[model samples]
Target: MRNKIKKWMRKVCFPISVTVCLLMIGMTVKAQESTSVKKGIFAGDIDLSGMSEAEARQAVTDYVEGLKETEITLLASGDTEVAVTAGDLGITWANPELVSEALEVGTRGNVIERYKVLKDLEHDNLVYPIQISFNLQMISDILLEKCVQYDVQAVDATLTRENGEFQVVEGKTGYTLDVETSIDKVNKFLTEEWDHTACTIALDVDVTEPRGKAEELAQVKDVLGTFTTSYASSGSNRSQNVSNGANLINGTLLYPGDEFSAYESVAPFTKANGYYMAGSYMNGKVVDSLGGGICQVSTTLYNAVLLAELEVTERFNHSMIVTYVDPSADAAIAEGSKDFKFVNNLEYPVYIEGSTSNKHITFTIYGKETRASDREVRYESKVLEVNQPPADIIYPDPGQPIGYIVYDSAHVGYKAQLWKVVLEGGKEVSRTQVNSSSYKMVPRSATVGTATADPAAYEEIMAAIGTGSVDHVKNVIAILTAQAQAPVESPEIGDE
Candidate 1:
């Protein structure tokens, strides 16, 4: 009976052993097939196994983000909803390496231990909750940035003088956000299961009382910079235009970041605009046009602004040299083609005072003087080149009597450099080149009609014009005198 039992056991044991070995081999092969962690696994209820690094990261992030939009309600006040977006309240993942940890869970220790971990992960469900906290300052910044629109900042009371007595101006009340309550609303949303989508918070306003009730304007007594230019040689129309333009700019107030436009301030230089026809440059010659001396006013203001160390935005020069200022110092303006502009870069407010006498136009700027008392500013005009004019052009007219000549103009061209010099305590501190101006030369011309009457006199006049007087206008009287003294030949051998 023992022998028979032994024989049956051997046969049954062999087959059973073969089946167990086959099952173990199959399980090992399945485990080894995947280099990464097995699937159907969860780290804190978030699936992370059997995925590439990028895929595992994405999966974990999605799970966290899904819980991020959870709504929080503020119930103390009425129903108001505030959605908590990502990065609000300084939202961030505590353990960002969770995916790496999940990958390593079944990978550490001995083979048996690793296999046991993998088996446990495959069989059981696990949830790992990460620690999330709010950053007080960062969250406050974000919340305040949004709340500023609802809250109005408190403004200080202003003072102004009117009717020779100081008047009281009522101060305005302002509103602000209750920061503590607002932060509470955000915390409740993050802590509780977001069921209600609305949150309510009331804005708290605080009264901002003014220091002084007089409401008197700031005492503006300092003269920041002032400039004056004489226009005594100007015609009646030109003088009117200058005065009109100056009047428009006078008593003008400018706050910070404000810009001044010469053309825009004084618009429509027509008869209706109190501007009359004056002599202005049309092409190359002077003609009767509207707003002739307006440019002079702008030029004067521009120089004053420069002296005050104000910022000049746009400026242009005339085609021909102006008689009022030096070459590059003058600022020319037309309605649409040209303009003069300056910006009020000072911290305090500024006012422009413009007044014109019959002899001069002046631009005085008033603002808080910030510069030192010892500092002085001046400009120097340096001549770089002298451009000689072209040859004289003579036009003969038969209507004129003998030896009659008209001298039109003598314009000398120049190339000059203007430097703005700053001095402190009689020492040169700095120098800035403002502009390089080029003036076009106008050639000297004379209409000598003596040739129609006397041949000898014509030769003498031509001889006088050709001599050493080639560069500039010289000896006009001498040439006329020489022509007068020339002897006329007798009406000789004409067989009449």
Candidate 2:
């Protein structure tokens, strides 16, 4: 019985000892993996086997930094190409946390499971793909700064008048980059398709065709509307300004659906732009200002546009009544505030021919005539209310002699409406209210002299000015003049 028991104990002890040794070996392997990544692991083709977390992170960082110099060629319209590096687009490592994930691999789960994963990685290495990040806006700005200059701009066909005939100047097509779409394409290629090396990308491009042709512009021979205004009363400077503004607007070509801006066509109202100091309206008063008579050019064009049956997009009435056109018939344009704009709504293009002759400025709009031969159109001004100016305004001037005075006549205010009367074969067909105007009443202004060596005369003139009456001021002037001119009486010779 003692021999049998000894044999049984020996068999049990042999198997139990082997199991304890294997458990201790497995714990030793897990402890080694806790300090560093497991063997047979990689981070984007970079082997990180048996490397510490810090070592693996550095390896991945270096890999990403090396990619910064990778060149990307951007091809744009017209055989244009721009070369850039990944650093220029703000590329950086996107997933540093992936390094930690690689370290944790085969470190989790029970001993048998961990052992199986490690064995599998021995034959098939685990790879964690390196992801990259970039600044989208940076890419966009780079493309705009480098690629925009290569884009070609489309040119619209224009018309020119020579020797009383119209000629058409052809236009050219253009090529331009589609920036937004190209940006998306670049991002997709870099993120999903690029192989961490140099590559070429074709930017999205757009084709723009020119407008109008020879046959289409040939229909602009007939005179659609013509208007003439007399600037004969204007001074030489004012007449020069009118003619200068007219020349700036001459030969302007307007295609169908194009809107013409009178102010834009003749702008930068400076001496360098052929403008002079002349009379223009300001706050219901006529003052000498630059680009003064330019309004007359716009007014004449406004009437011609009205007769042409064009669409007026914007129009403003003058602050004071002008002598060139009736009330509500004038169009006023001021710098930075007012503009006279009209659209060419006809089927064919129109040409603007402006000229100055015999102190008169005329604007003729030539286009294909579509109206009936017998049809006639005219505009009339109808007065609504008239406002009489108040008492005269007097200003004392100490610079001139006591009897000297300068005066300007008062302007009566008026409210009027313009009517567009269309007649077919000499019979009125329609009368439409075109526009309404309200002119401000400007009082008569007189600059009277109060300069006198006599204190009594100065005091008398001030008193007259306080009365706000031009007649009273004139009476004071007459009395003072008569006193000065009266013959002095000779003293009796016996008194001396």
Candidate 3:
């Protein structure tokens, strides 16, 4: 019985001893792992010595968050290898592959002399660089690439001499290019140049497509016929000159987009141009000229050009608007500054027909027939305000002493505001305000003073005031006022 009891005790004692040994081994391993833990060199660990406090904190945060590791293998340098291990000198440890990748991506690196040789060794390698989370850099690069894509629409004025005849690109060839291709290309360039603005492209005028020859020709004919019947006058002095001027303009060539100069194309002031030169109305008076009434010719042409719907490159109003044409409708030519210019917008050549008749001057543009929309142009003049002339000076005639009354006085100059209203199809569309030309009132040069009074001086005084010479008027007033209190006509010999 004693031996059996001892055997059972031994078996239990052996099992307990084995269990205690196992527990001791496990505790030893756990303690070792806790004391020598291996972690990767993260961005947060990078020391920023010179940075401001705020910068230092930001740098640390950005570094740790942005850090990444990659796998890499180094050549064995010596028998005593500085193994990649945690808590070892001249060694960095992380996930093996991650550490290698970090190095390849220009991240953590060995600083000691022992590891210097590893950097020069050439070998097949692969790794990933650490990247920041902000996508601004990536977005900027992509957007820059997109900026090159110019998408815009505009008219291209490419003039290539293809043949002897000069043909506009919009016509003859029908080279209508869309903005998506070429204009957009320019737009892209502009987009890069002007980052803050949108792109806009304008087509050349010819590219806007003027009417075809035949269509424009018909409209010109209609306008000429209407103008001849409506506005021509056969006054005694200007008879036959109007219609003849219109006949001269027919079959006159006007090229597309070309400017037509009236003074140059029409007959010179010489009688050879078929118009007689004589004294004609000029600045509210008569002036002698080779083509004294040529203004009527110019005025008629102005109306016709307006009817054709062509662009006016240059135009001017006469010093005083003509009565034949509405105030705004009259165009005056000043050698270089102003001129009546009309572009031949028709696709085909246009001819002008100008002539003068017993009663009126007429102008017509002839061309190949074309179809055009029916449009009528009309003008209405409205008087906005009338300004009376400055009070006329009732001068005591130099001949008559002071206190003499002259019932009749010459009219002075007056000014007014007028508006030119343009109507299309009976609908008021445009209004242009114009200062009505000031008209000088005719001066009365009556002899009220002594019969011996200087007639020439009196006439000169009247002329000065009529011409609106403010200084002269004031001087005359002063002289008259001083004389007013002096004396009555010397009581001729009859003796008062």
Candidate 4:
């Protein structure tokens, strides 16, 4: 019974093994036969030795028409799919005889030879279309190459203008390519679409300038040409020595707390300053110098500033009183030494306009008219204390003949203190102690000498010895003469 079972097993197992070996041999043979297959599009040749160039090309075109409807697809698993639509796929066959005829007849190749015309006809017009259809993956690769090559190209588009200037804009320039499109590949891929296209690229024209938030603050207000001044004169001069005119206008208007300076605004008189040199007060006498005639302009401007009730920023006095104005009313200015300055105490902008003619000089203050007005100034003087004149004695010497000298000090004068006060609403709002002045009591010295020593010379000697003022000698004489004539009236009252 065991031998019989073993025999049955050998028969079944041996036949089964032999059948499996045969099937394996068949599969290996099939793989070997397909290994040499080169799958791609195919182009055919047409004989057209007798045909013209146009006729040859036309025959190629007619042949390519047959392959237009062909479609090809690629699969991810090394499998392929193909569909041919007779209406769409095209085919073309090259005329080899025409190429051979040209090679034989021509010494040098023509345009046809340069382009490899016959081969190109089959390759570009016929085989290229067939390859793109039958070899779906090759179609995708070729389209990708076209897209990279034609990513940027020149074309035309419309331009529109809106604002200040024109410009140009960049646009997307690219070609479309097919990647994967097959029933078998579509099942395995995330997306399957063969979109092959020749694209048109262009540049967008921008016809406008940017204009949104670009403005300056200076353009909003019109305050360019407003200004002011105080007085007018020729070149810089002291007192009446300055003849007034446009070239001599002095004293600038202050914009609120603005500071003022004589030399800063008024240019110095020189040949470059367009002025004729004039005499200036020096040592109580006139001396010729550039800019010597401009001080009268400063004094006039000072008076106007006082009348306007502006704040005095800086002030100084002249060495001697000017004849054009009283001693108490004069104002002086010297570059880098003394200055006459005033600030606008008023609220609005002030413009100063001044002109001088032959007889008088005038300065006009211009601004927005308001209810505020200038304060009126008045001064009154009274004697505070008086000192008697000193006794004069003449000295005689042989070397220096008979001569006289006078002694005068501030102590030998009438001492007086003055006050300046401001009033508003009929009441004094402020008061200031202005000055403690002393008018000296002059002495008279009579000299009896040789005729060679003139009395004038003796008088000058006395003036030089004392205060160098004739007014002092004249005051003493007047006091003595008045006392001799009217013993009751005092010289102080006469002065008042």
TM values, all candidates: 0.49, 0.79, 0.37, 0.33
TM-score of the candidate numbered 4?
0.33
The Cα RMSD in angstroms, rounded to one decimal, for candidate 1 relative to the true structure is 14.1
Worst 10 residues of 1 by lDDT: 72-81
Candidate 1, residues 1-496, lDDT tens digits: the string is 9999999999999999988876785577456545564565565656666777678777767766665564432222122234445445565566767666656666667556666666676678544455455566765675566554555555444433344333334555555556776666555555444332333434333434433233222534468888999999877888999999999888676656889998898888888888988877655456678888888989999888988788899988876778999878888888779899999898766668888986799998876788999999998888898878776666554576445666546567888888999999999999999988887777766665444456665555556555624322235435556667889988768667
Ranked by lDDT, the better of candidates 3 and 4 is: 3
Across 1-496, the per-residue lDDT of candidate 2 in tens digits comes to 9999999999999899988866875876566567688878888899998788899999999999999999989998776889999888888899999988998887788787777787788799988899998788988987899987799999888888989977788998888999999888888888888889998899888989999899899888999899999999999889999999999999988988999999999998899999999988887677889888999999999999999999999999988788888899999999989999999999999999999999999999999999999999999999898999999999989898899988766888999999999999999999999999998888988999988899998899999989988888989999999998999999777754
Ranking by TM-score: 2, 1, 3, 4
How many clashes does the backbone of model 1 have? 11
* Predicted structure 4: lDDT: 0.43
lDDT of 3 by residue, 1-496 (tens): 9999999999999999988865664454333222111222223234332233355445544443332221111111111111111111111212224332333322224222212222322242322232222233332332233322322233333222223222334423122323234333333332234222222323111123343443333333233212443334434445444444455554455656767876666555556667665545444445556555555666677666655555556665564435575455565553445466777776655556566554556665554445333434544444333334354444435565332333333443344344545566667677765334444444433223322255655664566556544445556645655654567776457746
Q: Backbone clashes per model, in order? A: 11, 0, 52, 28
lDDT of 1 at 166: 31
Global lDDT scores for all candidate models:
0.69, 0.90, 0.44, 0.43
Off by over 4 Å in 1: 1-219, 396-408, 445-496
Cα RMSD (angstroms) for every candidate in the order listed:
14.1, 5.6, 19.2, 27.4
Candidate 1 matches the true fold with a TM-score of 0.49
